[model samples]
Target: MIFKNRLVMFLKRQCCFCGAGFLFAAIAFTGVATAQAGSSQPDVRISLDQAEQMALAHNRTLRADLMLISESKANEITAGLRPNPVFDTDAQFIPFFSPSNLNSDYMDNSAQFDAGLSYKFELYGKRKARIQSARAATVVTSSIISNDERQLRYQVATQFINVLYAESKLRFAEQDLATFDKSLSISQKQYQAGSISHGNLLKLQLQRLLFQTDVTSAQVAVVQAKDNLRQLVGFDSVPQNYDVIGKLEAPQPKLGLMDMEADALKSRPDLQAARQLILQSQSQLHLAKADAHPDLGTTVDYTHLAGNNDLSAFATIGIPIFNRNQGNIAKASAQITQAQEQERAAEQLVLTQVRSAYARQQSALQVVDLYESGYLKEAQQSLSISQYAYLRGDTSLLNFLDAERSYRTVELNYRQALATAMLSEQRLEESIGMSVPSGKVH
Candidate 1:
């Protein structure tokens, strides 16, 4: 009886251990699922303006361009500084071989010390020309940095729009799949009840597969778009599973083409940089001409020789006999011409870009308006009517499926049109080097 009791206790212990192990496993599985859910969710959501701010703060290329401005400023500072005066000291008649001839005192009989200071006086306003040239170069660098910021802003905005478009498509695909799921369930029941044929059920199943394919493609596109945006904004600043908050709707602006062109000419940083380059070249030409004049170097010296002290002063100048900066002057003149031509080219390019973007924007707006006015509503109504008719035995499965496909196509096309219009508007802003005021959407 005692042994039997012991066996019962042992069995109870075994049951307790088994229960504990099961409970542990359940907890572990729950934890894992929670972690997965959290990982799948987006860590951050940002608007277009916030995205632009992040990009400006974290973009490596933009940061590098900003550093160039500091470097140019440093050059300007260096150019404004005058040359340091030279100090000279010498010991003549030093007896290194014979210790007896060496002098213990600093100014002894057998040794002589000479010290002098020399300064080079820049002639023909050389220093002034250098300072001016450096200032002009700094202006060029500043303009370049400004242009880089503008371009970066445009890139970020475009990528942000792309992300929004991809997300919309993904949502549409999922919704379509869900609608098919309901239809598929109904079709399966009808087939089992002998109300629908096997062929019709098979067609519905195949249509579900197509929707599934679309969902997969849209998911991939979303991921790619987000990755591109993250890269532009900076990898560290954006999380892998972050979401963008923006619509693909284009905003209308009241500004005309001529106004845009005028703004572009006045505000385009690249054009300004090009013009600054012309000024820099002119300054360089003046500097080169100044270099043709010789500089004056003046020196003064004191000597203590054999207990006698003497002082001397002299000035030296180079005669501009042969090399009078002829080559540099020619090069600087040529650079001025080149800069002017480049500025003109930049202006033309800006105008062309504005026109192209305006055309695209107009076309996209038309398409979006057409879809929103009546076409999209009609497609949806047709699909709904066909679905109702099929369920009521008034239409075939083929007709219903055709309506579904048409609705999906129209919806996707509408989304694409919206994205295109938004992107074209961004391009217009970039070409004009300024943001147009947002107006009412059509």
Candidate 2:
């Protein structure tokens, strides 16, 4: 009995140890799993600032333009430096010698050795012109980058909002299908009980099919919109159900066409870049004119007599009697004219676009207000009454279906209005050289 008791006590201690280990492991695993899950699924909420950051980081075209701007800045650094100097030397063999073995005067023992550096100092504001041109180029490049960033931002906003619109449509389509499904079930039951005709049952079935088709189409649209957004953001994989983090609101730009045009001149990067190009061309023109004047190079010639200790230096200056660089100057002048014309054209085009976009924005805003005040509310009320009356057998099937269709149409139109208004607002923002709103979705 004593031996058996001792063994039972030992086994009990082992079981307790095992139980303690299992409890520790369970606790550890639960903590670890909770931590992992939390880290893996961070709430993917992005505000406008976040969107801008993502575009800066991930937008390929914008990034490329940014690199171009950097390159232009780099070139500007090299533009102000002078050209490197060159060293020249020459030698002639004398075949004549004073002794009988060689002639003392064969070829003229006239070899020249020049050891001097010549620099062409741009005397007439030429270098300054070049520097100004380069600075202008840099400005233009920076403006182009800004323009690209704005464009990408607009594209992303459109895709993001369109996704929301499609999702709304899909939700409504699903609801519509569910309603049809319930009605079909009731209709079938009624048909069996001789409460309705076969034609009515068939009609319900057809309505269900149509709703199903709409749902499918909406889903497809969602997929396509997601794909487009992914490409814009340079994402290879699709994101999970992204909710737009901003609410749609009417834009309140308080500027007219002339004001916008002036802002565009100040804000549009392409126009600035074109203006910079003109300056660069002007600089080149100056450079060509300077070239037309014979580039004066002064050289000091040093002569060391062979086997003698005398060293003599002589200075010489060069003048161009031919090839006076007229062609180059003319070409550069023509380029300047071309650049000026292009800048004018761009300015005009921007003005036209700003006016047109503002008009469209105004029209879209009016439509949104009209729908909100009159049409959308009426459609909703009609749909509600039709649904209730149909359920109570106080309305004909045709009337109910018509009302339902009208409600769907108005709902779709409302979503479209929201999209149009948002898109128009974006264009207007672009037109006026305004930055995107920093406001987040409500």
Candidate 3:
């Protein structure tokens, strides 16, 4: 109680000076807040933004997606390479049985020895076509991985909100328990003084059990929420005793559905990936057409036969009478159409998401406004009045208890509204494929 009084004193005045004063105020407030929160320091404290950054940096799933990009680049190297030359040396018609008659002239006449080197020269720019297709495919893969990052960002944000909500509920439960303890002490005094009946005191004592239950339930919720967040942020990044530092309060947002859709079209990685797929398909078609033309095989050889030495060259090519890659070329062409349709679908989905998220955000904001405008203060004031009246023998026990329950319900609902509002903002940003304007932090 004395600490809260001192905290209010520190929070009350404006800065004594400029820049330095602002820094001093910030540091002082942080220290006071830390001191007020707990006797021992937490292992770590993170805000929503920090949690998102940690998740992006340490997430194993994202690292695996990045590895796919490296794999695709390696494949590009393979696609750009040309075929290796074949070398051969052979001795034919050797007379192994006639050892006595194996003179130099007989060997030359009877044996035909040859050494040859051959290479297949690709036609229709096949190697170049392969390289283009591979590079385009890599571009597509990169965009897809970027889209994965977008999804991860959304996931991290939602989980961070969950942690914040749980913490809020836990704080409320503990604070409410403390308030009830004071009330119970007063009830005991009243019972001893003959100002309240024993039965009425017992009823108030039994209600303390409800407050204790709330605290226990809230503690479990905090543990479960943190555990779920740890899985997304990476277990190694933070200790088990880590805590999130934030409050439950809604910030007003200004967003338009049409503007959000425009941003999505420009910024959405999935949409970009879909468009890249069309280019990737076109490159594949080019590679397929290149495959229809047969490569030219050329060979040069040196032969020694009948005491004469000769050098000969040969060239060969398939007649293309049976196969011309007709099926693969047709398939590649059809894939281009498929990719185009996919891009169209992606664009439509992005717009639909923007609208849905916008509507949700609006609904959440309304609830937040409903709480903030009157219900929160009204509930607190009503509970305070009832408590004062009951202790002075001016109100019934039933009225005091009713007021306390109403206050608790209002506060819980308000916290939930705050969480819903924040989550809606996250969803909206995800639909737009970029971070929106920052809101006032409470």
Q: Which candidate ranks first by lDDT, i.e. highest?
A: 3
User: Please, what are the lDDT tens digits per residue for candidate 1 over residues 1-442?
Assistant: 7976676566566555556554554465456447547788788999999899999999998998899989988998898898899999998878777767675663476688999999999889998999999999999999999999999999999899999999899889889989989988988998899887665766676566567667667767877998999998999997887998877775675377777778889999999999999999999999999998999999999998878899999999998889899999999999999999998999899889888877777788888889989999999999999998987779998899999989999999999989988888898899888897654433
RMSD of 2: 16.3
Clashes of each: 0, 7, 0
What tens-digit string does per-residue lDDT give for candidate 3 at 1-442? 7975665444343222233544554465455446537646678998888888888888999988899999999999999999999999999777788787778877878789999999999999999999999999899999999898889989988888898899899889889989999989988998999998765776686577677667666767777898888888899889877888887778667546666778899999999999999999999999999999999999999998887899999999999988999999999999999999999999999999988998998899999999989999999999999999999999999999999999999999999999999999889998888987644422
Candidates 2 and 3, the one with greater lDDT: 3
lDDT (CA) per prediction:
0.85, 0.69, 0.86
RMSD of each: 11.8, 16.3, 11.8
Query: Candidate 3, which segments miss by more than 4 Å at Cα?
Result: 1-39, 438-442
- Give lDDT tens digits, candidate 2, residues 1-442: 7976676566566555656554554465456446545656434655555655676688777777778878887777787887666666554454345435344333223332334445554455656666766777777677777778777777777777776677678778878778778877877887888876555555665566567667667767766876677677667222554434665555554456566667877877667767777877887887778656543444444554443334344444445577778799899999999999999998888788788887897788788888889998899899889877876678888998999899888878877887788788778777766753433222
Residue 390's C-alpha lDDT in candidate 3? 97
Better of 1 and 3 by TM-score: 3
> Top model by TM-score, which number?
3
Query: Candidate 2: where are CA atoms >4 Å away?
Result: 1-43, 88-129, 182-194, 236-243, 247-258, 310-322, 436-442
How close to the true structure is residue 280 of candidate 2, measured as C-alpha lDDT?
Answer: 75
